[model samples]
Target chain A: MIEAVDLERTYKLGDSDVGALRGVSLSVAAGDYVAITGPSGSGKSTLMHVLGALDRPTAGLVRIDGRDVNTLSDGDLAELRNATIGFVFQSFALLARTSAVDNVAMPLLYRGMRKSARRKLAVEALEKVGLAHRLDHRPNQLSGGEQQRVAIARALVGDPKVVFADEPTGNLDTRNGEEVMKLLGALNADAGVAIVLVTHEPDIAAHASRQIQIRDGRIAFDSAAGRDPAAA
Target chain B: MTVLEGFRVALEALRANRLRSLLTMLGVIIGVAAVVLLVGIGGGAKQEVTSQVEGLGSNLVIVVPGKFELGSAPTVSRLQLDDVDAIARVVGDPNAVTASVTSGEVARNGTREMFTSMVGVTETMTTVFDRPVARGQAISATDVDTRRRVAVLGSEAAEELFGDVDPIGRQLTLAGVRLRVIGVYAERGSAFGVSRDGEIHVPVTTAHRILGTERVDALVVKAPSSDRVEELRPKLEQALVDRYPGEEFSAVTQSQILGTIGKILGLLTLVLAAIAAISLLVGGVGVSNIMLVSVRERTREIGLRKALGARQRDVLLQFLIEAVMLTAVGGIIGITIGVGGSLLIDTFSPVPAVITWWSPAMAFAVSAGVGVFFGVAPARRAARLDPVVALRTD
Candidate 1:
């Protein structure tokens, strides 16, 4: 689970200050399938970066799996990310020239797992994504859809509390995009894992049970906010 | 990640770019080889010199005119036959003393002629220097007393002048003096790069007349034993000093000469090795330069690893290990080539190369240390990269 309270992130772009996330507040609970949609430069990626413990916020606080992101050192933040968070980038970001199994088993390397055990767990995770037969294939050897599925297996191999996927289907064709979306849906439905997906496409955001639209570094709407009885 | 994983990752990275890795290692290879080879040549030369001096007999002491301190003008010797007698009395062996003057001259037999070293010497050499006449008879006491026109040819000189023909009892001319070859000296191997077999020996009495000089170049004394040389050297020099005050007569033994030559050769070898180490230093710089380029090329990988929970220390260790491994492996290749080269030189050339154990050992350690010394900046740069920025690099 990830929670952000008025998280603000600012970056310096040469001569001027660029505010990526301006007072954004959001939270995702256990087993939640949430999508944050925005145009390019809407700060959706920045929000995810802060909430996933990858980037420190310029202001406010973020809690990932109950540990305050502000209170952790850079190394401690890395360990927290290893234990509680997983990430999937649009490019897949699998190491070049590495086998699918080695790529999937990468996160567990941070967990200090032995090679044989990591490989076994990676195979199981790949099997969940229907890629068991392609364990030894490199990313360059795989099609876009298979590479995304391998990326999903890498995200799932750690058994993290949540996975942050930013534009997961941005580089795939329409058919491979549908396949990746279907795989993410199947994993969510069968395994009760929380996912915070960032996307710009409407159809991609439509797959989530709850959707939040971000415009100008702030949340424009939340699908579940009105449904919750606790929200006045 | 484990150290094993660090090595695996580094090795994989290097293996991925084979040519780049090899080029990066070239500097270190040349550096280490130079260190090994230059030092080996120096050590071998030292060994050769030591053995040659010992070959001349460790009991040998020579009293040369003037001070023998390095790099200063030597005092001239006015030594004569009386000095030989005085040296013979001090050593208490008349046959062990020989006073000789060496001159470079053209020796002729028919139309065949070669430049040769002609030594005008006392007849006592046959008993003292241990070189025997291989054919015919040696210089006798009568030969010196009568100033005989007979000469003993060295084996190489014999071969050069007469070829397959018998050299003994044949006519030979030295400088312009007509003489007969009475015998041929046995083969004696070279010493200090000059051929011993090119010398032609005539009685010292005839030498004074032909060379037109009464002064002996130096008085050579062969003591009864090595211990006697040590005992006799100072006494001989003191006798000379007592006989002729204000004239410095330096009496030196084989070991003293060996010590001086060994020191000079040792320093020369060290200087050469140091000069060679400069290329190694440049090679270290090359390693650092390539490592910097590699770190830049892998910025995204560094970010990804950092994102995957690699600590700064882990990243640092990975790159450092890669660097140390690069230089260490290169160092090994260099040592192999250097040793191989030394052996080749020793076998195929006149330059002797004696590989000491420390040259390779020191070379290896220094090369590895060069890795550590030069690797720090690039590795730190890698370790300090931000994960968010790194992962975003294309």
Candidate 2:
């Protein structure tokens, strides 16, 4: 399980302090499917970054599998992100010149696995995303939906405890977005993997079992927790 | 990451920007080639000089008056004919010794005059040095004992001064002193740029009268056996050194002369190599500049690698390895060109050039070290970047 209590993130922009996340708290258990919803600058994306261990919080605490985020060094944080969770970005952050299989095998590369061994796991992950035939094709050669599928394969290749998706289908067409959503549904339902995604679409938020809404750097609403006292 | 994997990624990155990488490597190539070629030319020059010294004669010890310190002119010639007799007694053959005092003078025959080395020598000159007479007879002991005004002309000197007419029995004037030509020396070719066949010889006793100097410039003693030359050198040196305790006499065989010449050439080669290494340092600076640009250009890639769990050392090592790979490949190409150039020069040019085994090897090592030394700053900059900010760069 992953947990956070009153996490706060602030940035200094020349003369002013910009608070991206202020007193936001959340939790997700094993096999849970959750969606965080908000408008632009609502701190929903900032919440995901902090929870995914990509950015350090300015205040409060975060724990993944009972280990405090504050206790880890930068290198330790990177290892935790690599071993315990996977991230899927809206931009499909795959190496441009690399083949789909090589892109998928990148996470395992950090673990010092043999090239052949990691490639074998990559092939299986690509098969799950219906990208087995496109293994040797580069990111530029693949279609938008195919590239997203390759990104999905990369996320699953490491066999992480949970998958964090920040606007995963924001760049896809209607049919492709539905297909990617369906893939997430099956991954959660059949494989018992946890999924936490950020989106503004009400329809996308409706897919998850639990929903949380962030507004002005604070948690405005949670379907499970009802209305927050601090919300505007 | 594994070393092999680092090399793989480095190779990939360099291939992505082939033209820029090749341009950066050009400096190293030129530098290494210069070093190797200069060293080769120096080595070959040394070899040629050694061979010429050995070819002159064998088992002959050249004894000169002075302290005999290297790189200094021989100090104050005080040796005389009596010292020659002393060496002759030690060698157990009175006929094995010869003395010479030489100076440049005009050899005038009738209205014609030419500059030639005027050599004053004892009668044993031809016999001790194994030089043969082409015509007439060599100077005998009677010639030196009686102080006769007779001379011998080197083949080229005789041809140039006497022309088609036979030089023997002709009168030639040296230093305004008339002398009868007794014999013509056989042909001995040039050594370095100077001709050995342009010298004119007379008996030491007569040279003292004409040149007006009693001091002998050189005392050459022929050892009985070639094997004894090494042992006899010190004995002859000791005999003369004992006679004049404060003065040092040098008695050296042909091989020792070769060694001295070799050492001078070796020093010249080192100086040339040092000058070439400065260019190599400039090449290293070029590599550093290009690598800095590469680190900036690939900031996003660095962040992505770190996000994928690459540690700071891994990122540092990747860039470092890339820089080293560039210089190392340049070094290999330079070596090939350098060795091939030495061979070409040796074949097509009169200037001797030989590729020694160590020149290319040293050049290669220096180029690789250049990579390690210059690659550090840029690689460390890449490693120190904040992954969060780096990932956000456009």
Which candidate number has the best DockQ?
1
Expressed as tens digits, the lDDT of each residue in A186-229 for candidate 1 is: 77788888888999999999999999888878887888775422
Clashing pairs in 2: none
Question: Ten consecutive residues with minimal summed lDDT in candidate 1 chain A?
Answer: A223-232
Q: DockQ of candidates 1 onward, in order?
A: 0.61, 0.47
- Best candidate according to TM-score: 1
Q: How do the residues B51-142 of candidate 1 rate in per-residue lDDT, one tens digit apiece? A: 87676678878789888766758766788889888888888879999888889999999999889988988888887778899999888889
Model 2 Cα shift for residue B336 (angstroms) = 2.1
What shift in Å separates residue B50 of candidate 1 from its native position after superposition?
3.2
Q: What's the CA error at residue A12 for candidate 1, in Å?
A: 3.4
Error of 1 at B23 (Å): 1.1
